[model samples]
Target: MVSQEKKIKVVLAQFPLETHNRGIITVAGMLRDAGMEVVLMGNARAEQIIKVAVQEFADVVGISSYCGGELALGDELLTMAEREGIRDHTVFILGGIFPPKDAPKLKEIGFSATFPPSATREEITSSIKSAIAARSLG
Candidate 1:
């Protein structure tokens, strides 16, 4: 029914359910401008996010959490990724309101990339490229 286009399918779970969500819309636009398929899942259920990611066969997942719960949620997300068997192929990126000091902690939990707040679009793009490059090398 629909056309199959080759684009970087992304699910943006970046932003609290109560916020205006303009930031995520902007970020999604940027990724779209870069020729990547972007899906904005504002305040979606965790299981739904996981289900959609698995069903869509998304190439990347972008989570945005700025609150204190990111630590716990991040860990749970990694666990969900593993359960879905997309841990290796999907590009796992976390963005928004992140503290740089915790990068190691997220990295340790199998996150392929982390984009803290104030990070430029180029930085995020570069991270994805780097992940692709690294995957190719290994």
Candidate 2:
């Protein structure tokens, strides 16, 4: 586990208007257990999530999309983050019910990582840590 001083601060949100929150809630628990500070912003719009990320000084911003609009949502969030000037320091990740093909598209849209429902707890935590590390290095 990381020490308190080095804990990765993450702000997690569900895509705007999305109702399937169980996956993100579970991920919040997993991240906390992994020693990262997680702020779960349930069902917030892209703008609200970006505001919270800035307020929290988040190292990572994660969105879970159970709905089919992952591409649009991801683009919107990235645009907002860029506007808020957190795009460089923040690692953006997306998860939940998206097509396998959309994963690459999401990445192209500025998500640092993408996860399907099949992603394991270890994979999620490890990927988040790695992304944070890479961001710091760059």
Candidate 3:
């Protein structure tokens, strides 16, 4: 009998005020095509995203920011996740328009990875899969 790997469950969200969503929408479709299950939450607040992540038992929590203030949003989301007790198992990733210098800051704030606009589809999917796998091992 062939054994199938469990599908990775991901919750994708954007800050409630963020209006640039085309990239995130495309990413959601890409993740789904990569055999992962994705729950896309449009214009969601940090708390809402955390609630959904918990309810969905999501392996990954992805946030997209295009209207700026990614650092603050990322920090807020991580704080909320930590408060909700899901910080240990869930992989957090950030994507969208942000200063290149902010990537390390985001990672330091607890995002597992950050993707710039130039990131390829393969890179995003592979990194997410790798992060989830690493988290499981850890």
> Among these predicted structures, which one has the highest TM-score?
3
Clash number for candidate 1 = 1
- Tens digits of lDDT, candidate 3, 7-95: 89999989999989999999999999888999999889999999999999999999888878889878899999999999999999999
Off by over 4 Å in 3: 1-3
TM-score of every prediction relative to native = 0.85, 0.95, 0.96
Local lDDT at 126 for model 1: 77
Q: What is the lDDT of residue 122 in candidate 1?
A: 85
| Two-way TM-score contest, 1 vs 2, winner | 2
Misplaced by over 4 Å in model 2 are 1-5
Q: Which one wins on lDDT?
A: 3
Per-model tally of clashing residue pairs: 1, 0, 0
Q: Cα deviation of 116 in candidate 1 (Å)?
A: 2.3
TM-score for candidate 2, residues paired by index: 0.95
- Greater lDDT among 1 and 3 belongs to 3
TM-score of 1: 0.85
| Model 1 stretches astray by more than 4 angstroms | 1-5, 15-20
